[model samples]
Target chain A: MASQAAIGFTRGAPSLDIIDTEGLVEATRLAFAEDPAGTTAYGTAVGYAPLRKWIAEQHGVPVEQVLVTNGSMQADAFLFEQLVSPGDAVIVEAPTYDRTLLNLRQRGAEVHPIALHEDGIDVDAVQALLESGVRPKLAHIIPNFQNPAGYTLSAPKRARLLALASQYGFTLFEDDPYFSIRFEGEQLPTMLSQDTSGSVVYASSFSKTVCPGIRVGYLVGPAEVIAGIAKIATTTYISPNMVSQSIVNQFCRSGRLDKSIDTVRAALRQRKDALVAALERELPKAEYTAPQGGYFMWVRLPGVSIDALADAAAEHGVAFVKGADFLLEGGDDSVRLAYSGLSAEEIDEGVTRLAAAVRSLDA
Target chain B: MASQAAIGFTRGAPSLDIIDTEGLVEATRLAFAEDPAGTTAYGTAVGYAPLRKWIAEQHGVPVEQVLVTNGSMQADAFLFEQLVSPGDAVIVEAPTYDRTLLNLRQRGAEVHPIALHEDGIDVDAVQALLESGVRPKLAHIIPNFQNPAGYTLSAPKRARLLALASQYGFTLFEDDPYFSIRFEGEQLPTMLSQDTSGSVVYASSFSKTVCPGIRVGYLVGPAEVIAGIAKIATTTYISPNMVSQSIVNQFCRSGRLDKSIDTVRAALRQRKDALVAALERELPKAEYTAPQGGYFMWVRLPGVSIDALADAAAEHGVAFVKGADFLLEGGDDSVRLAYSGLSAEEIDEGVTRLAAAVRSLDA
Candidate 1:
């Protein structure tokens, strides 16, 4: 077989320039030097205290409400395991995060996806679904610049979503990994901030901001919900790695997190601009959203078959995710390209190739 | 108000050391240096390829058979989630890992613990249980230096155990984190190596050997079992963090793994000796086994109530695990002391305090 090609525009990982490798190294070295025995020994279950405290302060949530997880992904899985049984009904936004969709599917939950408009998830559609006796056990949303769709829920939509959750008696899972890296637009309040009935379980991660390799993410919810997730976590990995936790805790405490996020936001913004410009100039006929913050752009290649476009792109040594991958129902003719990791120049070239691929595809 | 004592051992978690801060920093650095774009991006579900290759080589298993997990605890949890359901019967060694017990209990499985003897799990008991119409869906065992019990199945018993598994339709789960840390005795062959029925899901971890902070571990088994676990893992964490995996792969490949193990083993051996010596000098009436490897020493303190003993030890500023924590039945008088994390001097002091507590209970 010919050498397998491995290039893709379909990842949610952070960029290296934003990762603060030197800072992490220094922090780790300091952690070890400061306390080798502490680093090697056992740690707390909820998380390292300092890290938990820092996260609690950062998110404006109580430390008791937070539980550090292996990653935000684990946080999501743990919550679902506790909340959703096989065949349980879970709601989602159409073209949501693929992994979350897959997670619910794997759990044997019947997922109900509401249409996502350019502004965000259609609140009225969600209300209608809940009213139709769906009574979902959970609704998974990426309120801050969603994956694949790259659309942020407006402030009013956030409030309405939470209100609907309370009325319908379903839990709201707001996954906001890209909450801090917006390239433009006024920051919209998160579902957690707007939650009035304590129905929202908020998850965020250092992975998108600092490093994914550390596998340190956390969950914030009502104490009982946090406890339930903790039970799942206890059986799973027991706890996140304390060595990484402690060092990250130290880094955050030392005021490194702010600096790192600043550097990351600037780099991601430049790259996002490059990708957006390329999409506009080369594929001007295509419809897509430019995200205010976060890493991705969702392009609607109207009339073009996504499969044909993907195949054509692969031939040109470019690979991106098709809309079908993100949908609860497949066969959508859209594409998502992440412009975070690649440099501006590569972003232009990759999108140029993608534009060519879409143009070549049959309508 | 005097500070209320933390109601539980709320702060102690041995699982946190798997994250490896120094390794993570270096991994992050190298990840950026080698593939700057890849570090911040999403990784393959199969894990970082080098890490999988390293783990496979370390275990003498094929790469196809090994799947990296956040921790061995997660490996066990995922396996159970995939294989067993409510009311399913699972065979476990009596007085097993508490987390294993909890995982099974949470799943609402009927747990049947085969009583363990010094020679290891009572093969006769296991065989009898298998024959007794339990029809267990899974059999969870720690064939190499088991947790809590500190028993390694004798050579003959190993064969018998494998035979029983083959005869029974149950899948065997071999958790062997402590296999390589043997301070004395010839290393026994692993159950995975002896397994013939393709029924064994062999799990191991770097926590006991290196550190627990990074939450890195792996499982080797038939591809189907692994696939199922992968599905559970996918739902749980989307994917294990790539940063730590890359770092560990680099560390292992650099020949530092052996050196690290040597360093840890030396310290663990000294600590073990300290406890064994303390037991001989002070708690002379107690019955205990000299562990061949791993951190724990299982002691059955004579004529002292385990609860009283634990209470007294804690009062004296020494902490030990109560035996009841590790039992399905009949370990009310036993206790487990992990001396590895403490220094030789601390082990001496801690055991002495424990001995005094035991004496005072009788007084």
Candidate 2:
């Protein structure tokens, strides 16, 4: 099933063009000069400290609160492993990140979906679920331009969501991998930045801004939760790749991270704009959310079956994630079109093909 | 405790010196060109196909049986998480890798320790443990020159160990990170290579041979086990870093992997000899096992507490892992010193310090 997904899409990843091999060589050289033996050996489970400290400082959280991981995905997995056990109820946003939903479901969590609106996941729906005795172990939200959906949680809802979380007694998993990828909209305060009850377990990643070739991300929560995750980390990867972590730390510390982020932000915004505009011109009838940040656009094709659209689109020289793939298969009518890793011409071409596919589905 | 460990080891990695940054750059560049989007974006859970294929080909396993992971540590953790639930019976060799032991114990497993002999784990003792009503869920072993103990499981004993596992209905976790690092000894067939029962969940790494800084490793096992681990990997890091995985795959495919292994083997053997000779000259009273392969030497100080020795050595600007750290705390009088990371002069000076520390403990 996953292999088929790979065969389908023409992905756009700017980081590929941006990965500084010269920098890695320089870092590797510096790293070897300092500790040749330690490089090949195991590292700390909490991640490289300087990197952790940098992340904490970046987020305005205490250093102890930040924990490094292989990627934000790993961080999410750690949160689930530490908090959500088998048979536990998880409150997830519908049309959410497919992988996050899959992780929770695979772990045997009784996943209950809270509908996502244009702004983000509905607070009232979550409240209703909480009141109806779902007793969700966690509420996983990608408040900042959520994957695929590209829907940032509104500021008004953020406070209410926190309140609901406090009242409901379920931890909130704020996965904001694309937090810094904002191109057009005002940045909302993070759910974690406002969280007061210690009910938020936050995850972020450098895959978007820096480089994904190394797979370095982080998890932040209470110390106990972080400790549990650390135990998991120890058992799992021993410590994350210290070499990559150290390189990233150096990259960020040396001010290269800021420049890289600027590069990614401008490129992504241009790519996102081109894709959105192309889709509008080519298929205005197809309903899709206009994204402020991030790489994906959740498209709802009214009167067109997503599976059929996906099949047709692929046949027409364009490929995208069928909405049903994001849902429990055979459960939803949404299709996720990721424009994050495409060139302007490719995006236009892909959307044009998608438009043709959509029209064919209606016919 | 973990913080202290991370702090004490502040030097650069040795394997980084061996890494061909130019080759790596070329590989990364090629990989990015092919899957520019895949390398930066979220990828399949099982791992990148090229890397997985290479790993499968290397292990002589089917492609379906291989999983590329962040590192072997993650593979170990994933297997433990999937196979050993809380209070699950796990059989481990006493004086095993401390991190692996910690991984299982922290997961609430009833860890049954089998004594280690020079040849391998005491199969008779393991059989006795198996017979004594502890139905073991898993038997984890380092079949090559293992951590701390640095003892290879003998060929005859390997069959006996597998037989015991079969008789007892337990899975064998064959960790062989050091398998290809052999210098002086004859290369033994791995448990996975010889297994007919489809039982061994094998793990290995490029850290020892290429450079651990990149943190690329793999796990090979039955399809069901690999599937289960894949679910965990999906949640953990979604997938391994595609760039790293692809680069390593390319490097391996180019046939440099064998040459790289040979380089590491020669370097480690030289360091091991230097350490051994230093021990002979400086601390003749300390009974030490000369490792035939891999990076560690197990030194036992009779009538002197290894903890005291470690502390005294630390004071004198040298450090070694106390045996107690490897086993459950409050272990036997042994210390594990790794020579792979340090220079020959450092090894000699460190051992000389260790000798003085032993004298100080006696005094």
Candidate 3:
């Protein structure tokens, strides 16, 4: 019925139930109680020292290699601004985060879209493009639980990409926000960790792990580039949100962050199962690679036009992102359904509504 | 002795004693308990609606005219990106906030520096430039307690600026973080409030009023431009720190913000008086405009090179910014001393040390 509430699978934000509210509250108290100066003052653009140290310890990088930002998106934007000057060529997955693509284009970067497989981005395609004298300044890779597609890069491919970046003299932007959210399979070594040369610049966020509203994210790279980005950040906003970083630092140190991640993983696992089962039973014609973990399931119906289905799906009280929105071109028949923010019941309901819309479109 | 601790006048941050720590603790609790979704979710780049509504009510604008950012500096950068393309001319105060000048130059804007008097920016100079066919796309004005200079814009100049902006088809950017921190005389109306035409985009921050670590700031403009900026914010970073904004909302709603502002004003007034008295007693040759309110006092030593004075000042356990840092060129004898972050006794001590430094420079 039209009166039924819309069951949205659009945003990849975590559900309220999955967040550790009690832990965050306690963490906030600890942050304020312990270090009032670090928590309340105008912290330098290098970020709160303790938070950076914590991240540095986690990554095995020196403290100067880390720059804490408002969010990983800000980190992405800063690195893009630093690396990709106007008219410089860059490589990206065919279906990448639209926001990153928009930023690259805004900076006048010549975008080269490489195809992606279930294992992750086409490294051979990137190598081929590089061999063809593309000479990209940057290669933006999601690395794990890739947005829109939910594909993780294989270890071999990651190694290859690093090598290509080293050889091509391009920066490999390892945008790995979902690295820790894997509910299944062994985590692959990051391109940053794998790089012998300083070709990889890594980015991750506490948004998905700790909660989005805290706005804590960071970048890890060579000290030189990190210092350059910090300079840009210093001029951009004198500093990031130190209060949030302080709280997040507490969360990480207090073992609450790991606990919260476990809780979110359990909930997401259930949601993903519900989504897959519902899709199989309801829209049998649809095709997708089952995501091992992360927030999304990318699917394409054999004959359905996503634009028409989107309107029909809305009337049927379901919402999802059209996959074409993530790509520069193509994906007219595809959709990206984020299961992270929904429960099993909501996922089932949303998939039913989506199936009903597709059937209606055919009729 | 070389072992004395440095009393720095470099940062314009508030002294922690004036921050309402107890009130903030309560606000954080209230924000977390009352509005869990609004405080913890991935709020839209347009910002949390309640916070936007509050800011809109404060400014007497529609909610659509507001876009909350990580900080007002981000608001400044976004507007610069939106308005000034490469080589587009823009006007700014000569010895203005330096970070602002950096962002403008980074965007490749041809910055036309206007002079400032005790009353405010030299509107006549801007008028001359515009009259002489330098059609600047935008003019950045800090109407209240201008940074580094600590001068307030006169009402007449404010009116003329609004008129000039309208007549020349230029956007008047009123970057007024220090608007509410005025501790003396009658409060002046914002240029945004006084403008009859839709030519003004105004920004303000909770960094000075509430606390810096929160990183909550906002922009108000016509709905169309606000929408455009919101779009840019969305692609750059999906949203701002909602937890911080929610706490700030609580701080504002419960009247704690008013109390905090009162405490800060009282403290700043004492520090300002101490600074003026000490300057008179210690270094009669150092000419300065005694600011009635705000954090900074701009002073020019008749013949002392700031570079030499800075080195001497450092050794004497005092620190102040060389005002030349704020200008593109030619401020070799000026310094900006921020007294807000220090107590009256500390200001006196610092000025004494500063006098000693000047003596050393003469030697």
Candidate 4:
């Protein structure tokens, strides 16, 4: 069973070795030891106060503009619930996060997909859609390193997206979990930072940076929007997990978060480099982006069907996500490979196996 | 500010002294020490595996039928998201949990509130609603120690309610957060325990039984329903808090939960006794149920508006939730007093102050 098991390139999980498990455990222990009762009692629906304030300060926002959530996904869910009425127009990038697409579809939004380029989503296409007289209630974008796409939205596009949101009267829902994971390239200004019209609702998660098991995230937006989301949160989860929040709060306050992120960034850079080199050596015909950071790389194999490639790759003991899963329309020749959880050696082996699978398909 | 503060009878929080804080801290510590990586990594959207298995074992259900949630409220949100469409009929107890009512309202559920009596909800009224051709998508009930009412659904009513659900082709959403909190009377069989038709979606929380800050809860239902809820959970929060679930799993497996429950029951029973005796002495005119267990006592003050009484009580150094907050139609002369958070002495003082408030309103 072990011999036949696939080398996984489909998981977005952070490498376990990179996680500061000792620090997390110590923080949790301290949280329980210091104030067990307070830590274990019901917290406000918005989140634990100190954590919310901390996040607010980090984002240079007022506390009223910030709300802590179970995770960034919960933040997305709450904002979707608050903004997307049935049949409302919602804009999404073509190759966006699949779960976000599912959420928008479930919310009954008429999702308009804008083409995602190497630099970012096509702002001109979005502008065209807006000019077509579709009044979108929200536009969900990952301005930093996008999931599945691994492309950062250019600074110019970020500015334009903010302007479009203002002109079209839609909320720019910026999901930026990988904003701090950059290993190269200059950091782009966030859509939230660029927006003067209070149209950007920014969300980020500790899942990628700290620990997903803690389930902590924060949303920053206008006070009224935050309050509305908090109300939804009250009826949804009552409160975010205070025990985990307290632990995270301690981890942040102790300045361990910076060190943890540094370790993660360094490790991820190594893995990303290994995957890119392996791809070049093994799959010469494959077209792919070298992501500066984040978990995924969008790969296009010329003359190869993504479905067949994925199936054959699995049989050859390597696995990846079919790119069609990320797109609403078409991606028959594409796949998404995640290298964040794999070691450099494992990535090399996985790419070699994937190349063998591709050759076998041709044979 | 401390001197002028009112005695608080308004909190739904469990007493801090009663929680086995040391045990909780130890469990958390053990969880971290045993498997920090597994405990702090991404888990399945359904929940942490061992915790789901444990809950399944406790409920005598299959693991597939159990999905751990952020809290019981999140379970409700998932189910509501799955089952209720806009304008769908939903049966709720007249004086149900305010959050449930708010969630239903937000979902655009045509909420039909049936009267809640001393022995739980008016089952006959529910039957009448069904018989009157109102086909509700779900009937939500708190079978044991119903929130704000301090009533248990009789065994016969539970059976009848199940039958009604089957007859009406609606799910019976049995929310039993306080199931294990019984301090007196014989324990009633759960609606889920008696269910054979697979129409009951049972939800319960460790927040009340273990600790709220941990934010762990679960749902048991048909595999298909659980799968659907898990799908929603995927888009909602991605997964339940594994750190908390791991700790709760440790707490349960270590044979500490039973002892903790015993401690809580004893403390709550004492506080209930104090509140009951004080009400009898200080405000004999007010009618209230002496709850067998749970945190709340429902009081109906004769010839007094609850809002006015709540205002008067606050000014006279006491506080409680006005009954109107818990109802759909009317609770003008009622209020909900929670005794779980207060000490026995505080309960007596709070009641005495409440009596003074009542007199002041009359004066």
Here the TM-score of candidate 1's chain B is: 0.91
Q: How accurate is candidate 4 locally (lDDT)?
A: 0.89
Question: What TM-score fits each model?
Answer: 0.91, 0.85, 0.98, 0.96
Best-to-worst ranking by lDDT:
3, 4, 1, 2
DockQ comparisons of all candidates to the true complex: 0.47, 0.42, 0.79, 0.73
Deviation (Å) of B59 in candidate 3: 1.3
Query: How would you encode candidate 4's per-residue C-alpha lDDT over B214-297 as one tens digit per residue?
Result: 899899999999999898788777788998999999999998999999989999899999998999999999898798989999
Candidate 2 vs. true structure, TM-score = 0.85
Cα lDDT of model 3 by residue, A1-363, tens digit: 789889999998998898887788888898888998889998989888999999999999899999999989999999987888999999999899888889999889999999989999987788789888889988999988889898888988988888888887889999999988898888788988878899999999999899999888999999999999999999889999998999999999999999998998888888889999999899898999888788988998978999999999999999999999999999999999999998899999899999999999979
Q: Could you say which candidate leads in TM-score? A: 3
Candidate 2, residue A167: how far the Cα is off, in Å = 5.9
Ranking by TM-score: 3, 4, 1, 2
After best superposition, candidate 2 residue A154: deviation in angstroms? 1.9
Q: How is the predicted docking of candidate 2 categorized under the CAPRI scheme? A: acceptable
lDDT of 2 by residue, A156-242 (tens): 999998998898888988888888889886888888888889889888888777776668889888777888888777667667877
Candidate 2 at B242: error in angstroms?
A: 2.1
Candidate 3 structure quality by residue, lDDT tens digits, B162-189: 9999999999999999988888888989
lDDT of 1 by residue, A33-74 (tens): 676555655555677777888888876888889998777887
- Indicate whether candidate 1 or candidate 2 has the larger lDDT: 1
Error of 2 at A348 (Å): 3.8
DockQ-best of 2 and 3: 3
Q: What's the lDDT for candidate 3?
A: 0.90
